[model samples]
Target: MRGKAAVVTGAAFGIGRATARLFAAEGAQLVLTDVDRDGLEVLREELAKTGAEIRTVVGDVSVAEDAREMIAAAVEDFGRIDTLVANAGIIPLQTVLETTPEDWDKVMAVDGRGMFLTCKYAIEEMLRSDGGGSIVCLSSISGLAGQSGQAAYGPAKFVATGLTKHLAVEWAARGIRINAVAPGTIRTERVRQLADEPGGPEYLEAIEKLHPMARLGEPEEVAAAILFLASDDASFITGAVLPVDGGYLAQ
Candidate 1:
């Protein structure tokens, strides 16, 4: 990844943050974006200590202008975009009856529409640059198979995975590779909170048992998969969804 320019969205925390750190350590210059201004700044300060070229833009991916600026910033800062980790997303676990119209729209706005905007602008930049690059979007096991409580979240990830395949075929002749990572239950802080909710412990225990590994995954594990798809190692791969699910999806 040395000398490569990359961009990571929703990079303030979880898989996004871990991906940024790994990218930096692997010698990629980066532009990170997220709605969390403070988290972005703080992450930048931390990554800077390692002599990595890191820049942050505060924006919501669902907003067109913000998404555009995020890609533009990468071109302006690092000269070209070699890779993009379109990881900004939100998951609201609720049954259809429990879901409100407004909140569902909000989830679609960010997780579904937001990813579309980011990929659109990022591909535009990559197309205009020296050569085509790789794009790794974060999908989920829910997108692969339906979940009981992910009425809205599952569909949004489906959109992301669908976009990856369409663009991978659409741009393959141009040397562009687009793929997605469908992660199983990753043990992030957000999941911990979900586990702490009412009856959540029992819920999580049951969830964990469903996995053949009988354990949740880690953010770094997903980040590692994202890195592989972004790096030259996956040169022959595109339009594919890699499952980092502790064999949960296999079941």
Candidate 2:
């Protein structure tokens, strides 16, 4: 990934942050964006200490203008975009009856709409480069199967899977590869927060038991999968949803 330019959204924490660090370690120049400006700045400083070329953008992925500006920043600063990790998402787990219309819209806006906007702009910049690039969208195990409390979250991820396939097929001729990483039970700060909520810990424990590995995944584990798909190691791979779960989907 040396000399390549990449963009990672929702990069202030969790999976997004891990992916950004992984890419930087491989010598890819990075453009990181997140709504959490303070955290983003902190991460920017940390990565800067490693002597990696990185630029931080404080913006909401749900906004179209923010997505546009993020891509522009990548091009202006790095000359071209070689990869994109559309990892921005929000999970508001609610049953059908428990979910309000606004809740559904909010999840859809960030997870579904935000992904669409990111891919749209990323592809535009990628096409300008001599060699097209790879794109990895963050889906979830919920996307491959149903979960009781994911009324809104599930559908958003399902849409992301569809988007991945569509982009991979439509852009294959242009050397653009689009794929998705569906993670399950990753141990992240978000998961910790969810576990602290009512009945959240029990729910998480049950999920862990269902996994054949009988353990929760790490954010770095998912980041490894994302990195594989984004790098030349996966040159022939496209339109596939690679699961980094501990056999959760299998069971």
Candidate 3:
């Protein structure tokens, strides 16, 4: 990945941060973005010590203007974007009956529409480069199967999967590849917060047992999969939803 340029959104923490660090180690010039400005700064400093070329953008993915600027920054700094990881998202736990219209719209805007906009602009910039690029969207297991309380999040992610396939077909002849990664229960701060709540630990333990692996996944584990899809190794792969779910989706 030396001399390659990549952009990772929601890169302040969790899978996004893990992917940014891994990409940097592989010699890719990176542009990391997130709405969490403080976290982004801390992450920038931590990774900068590695002597990797890095840039940071503090903005929300739900806004089209911000998405455009992020892509523009990558091009302005690195001359072209080689890969894009549209990983910014929110997972609000709410049942169908409990979810409000506003919540549904918010989740869709960030998880579904945000991905569309990112791919839209990234493709535009990538077409201008010497060669085309790859794009990976962060989807979830809920997008594949029904979950107890993922009314809004699940449907929105399902749309992300669909978007990935659509773009892959529409742009394949143009040399751009698009795909998605559906992650299972990963051990992140968000998951930890749920587990710390009343009965949340027991609930999580039961869920863990349901997976054949009998363990929750790590953010870096998923990051590894995303990295592969973003690299030349996956040149032949497109419009595919690769599951990193510890066999949860298999069952």
The C-alpha local distance difference test score for the whole of candidate 3 amounts to 0.92
User: Poorest 10 consecutive residues of model 3 by lDDT?
Assistant: 194-203
State how far residue 231 of model 2 sits from its true place (Å). Answer: 0.5
lDDT, candidate 2, 80-166, per-residue tens:
888999999998878999999999999999999999999999999888775899999999998888988899999999999999999
Give the Cα lDDT of each candidate: 0.92, 0.93, 0.92
Pairs in clash, predicted candidate 2? none
Residue-level lDDT tens digits of model 3 in 39-104: 999999999999989999988888999999888888999999989999999988889999999999
- Ten-residue stretch with the least lDDT total in model 2: 122-131
Error of 2 at 169 (Å): 0.2
- Compared with the true structure, the alpha-carbon lDDT of candidate 1 equals 0.92
TM-score of every model? 0.98, 0.98, 0.98
